[model samples]
Target: MKDEKIVGSFQLMKSLNKSLILNTIRTHGSISRSDIAKETKLTPPTVTNIVNELLEEGLVKEWQTGSSSGGRKPILLKINSSNFYVFGIDISPREIRFAITDLNAQTLLYKTITMKEEMTSSRLFQMIAKQLYIMMDEACIELKKFVGIGIGIHGRIDADEGSSGFAPQLQHRNVPLKKELEKEFRLPVKIENDVRAMAIGENWFGSGVGISNLVCIKISHGVGAGFILNKKLFHGTNGLAGEIGHMFIESSGLKCSCGNDGCLEALVGSEGIKQRTLNKISLGYKTKLIERTNGMIENVNGQLIYEAALEGDLLAKDILEETGRYLGIAIMNIIHLFNPERIIIGGGLAKAKNFILTPIQEVVEQRALTEQAKKTEIVLSKLGDQATVIGAVALVLNEMFSVQYESVS
Candidate 1:
């Protein structure tokens, strides 16, 4: 009985030790074995054993040592970023962007596909596969070297079934994107909401790198958000925790795409901005916009409206003023509820920094409880368009830490 107990304890300790080594290397790249041991609270011999196993699997590599103190210089060890590549695709209503990246989230190649507003899911999937094939061919990547594919659709993703739950942009419901692709590529597959993917990218390598409670809000094509609470991606029970777009602010307001009235996204999405501006222009709202750009609806985005406001376009300025005011109302709600540390704005429309952010900051300060509003900071996403792709890569890398998340090959 004592021998049996001892053997079981040994196995448990070995497994725990292996996890520590892997996690240490993941957080601190190019760390010496000694440093890893110190950080992971592992014996040097145990770390060496795990490191050797990982090296044999091509997951870790020993780098030439940099300068050290007078004592013997330690050989630097790092995760082999080139051991395999990951494919990430962001499929939107107007465009599908595909990128191939190494394990460390460095882009190797990228391609884009443009389509009409009302397109079918089947055709879109085929186009995506074709584009991905071309990108891989251009990059000269062998099929075996690619570990798997990750797709970021601009909707809620049920990754367990590899389906897009309610992607209004795709005009399809419950499309099993990853499952179908897995059959064709013969590799593992994962799908995520684009907003959540952006948050993942930030969590790994961007502004949210060290922060715990944060929000990544994107306001292009539509307004969506992803949340990081206590350093973990908090997906509510239905994977819809961060679906703050439909948070009701106006009960008698215009009908939203989600069949709701007065959603935050309904007020602030690109469509809303476009419609509001055109309505004002049609109603003889005078502004320098006509003289400035010669009456071009083509030139009017949320940012253009901000610029027009700055350039003395009364109509454009009014749009921003109202937009900022509404945004603040929504932010006040978030502050009271989440009490987060930071709210990082991303997406195409966040370009109107001052016009959008100032109002939001003001509203939060005025409306929200003082202490709650003080905790959050509204800012921009540094990764920009790269966030979704980088986040997809981060998703795959994180799976290694999960005991149940399996590999493809």
Candidate 2:
């Protein structure tokens, strides 16, 4: 027992030292073993040993020599961004988007395909494989350089098993997405909730770069949130930590996909906005939407409503203003609960821009605690349509570079 404990301790210490050394090299960019030792506070021998291991693994490479300081010039080290590539895929209810990116999350190829009237798990996986093949062919890169494929699905994901238990948007249950992809592509796979993936992407490559505590709210077919707390994605005990869409917003609101009434999703999601617009029209509200859709109310969607508002349609503008207010209330609730450093609004509705963000900001400022509101910067996602796909890539990169050490592969 004593020997086992000692062995475990030694392994833990070695992993921690390796992580520290790697992080120092990544952050400092062209760094030497002595510089890594100084930044990580690890002994020079430890830094050198770990760096040699990383070099052998091809994760780090020696760069040009640094300036001499009255002695021999030191060799600099940097992360080998081209050593491996990650494929990111975003599966949504209406469309499938995928991209190929380097270890640095720089997108090389991106494509979007609209979903047919109905989709099954088999069809979905086949579509993903087809696009991946096309992307790889276009890039003409060696397959051996591929590290893994990351998938972001619009639903609850079993991270450990890489399966989805329930995806209301997909109307599918218990799909073995990860296993299927790994079998088809013959590569390792990482799967995560779409919004959560976006949050990871933001933290690693986008706006949340230096910020530790942040929230990413996605509003589209449904509402969901992803959190980065204390420099880590906070997955609650049940991995449902960021399901803010179901937060109670109205006591008498319409029914939500989760079978809840008055949930925030029921009030501000894409369907919710469409339902509200239909109700207003039914109640004889005046607007150019009727003429815009040629009197086909069923044809109205969040995008059409936004377009109508842009065209100076009164009802459409009112609908969006109300949607923004509800969204603001949601943001206020997020502020009071998490007190995050930044709140990012994403998804299809994000395109509403000032039409939606303005109202959300106004509500948050007026309703949330002054201190929390002041500290939290609410802004639209900088990634736009690429957020989820980039986030998928981030999932692989994040796991690869995470300092937690225990989960590092």
TM-score of each: 0.84, 0.86
Model 1: per-residue lDDT, tens digit, 69-120?
Answer: 8788788888787877888887766677788998778888877767765345
- Model 2 lDDT per residue over 1-409, tens place: 1123222111232465676776677777788878777877888887888888888777789987746777767789998877768899998877889898887888888888898744567777787888888889998866666777888888743334344434342323324666676676666677778998998877777767777788999999878998888777876765667788888998756997667798888989888998999999999999888887888988899888999999989999999999999888888888888889998889999999899988888888787778657557888888989999999898776655557311111
Poorest lDDT segment (10 consecutive residues) of candidate 1: 1-10
Task: Give the residue spans of candidate 1 off by over 4 A.
Answer: 1-20, 117-121, 156-175, 291-300, 401-409
Residue ranges of candidate 2 with Cα displaced over 4 Å: 1-17, 65-74, 156-175, 184-186, 404-409
- In TM-score terms, which candidate is top? 2
Best by lDDT: 2
Pairs that collide, model 1 = none
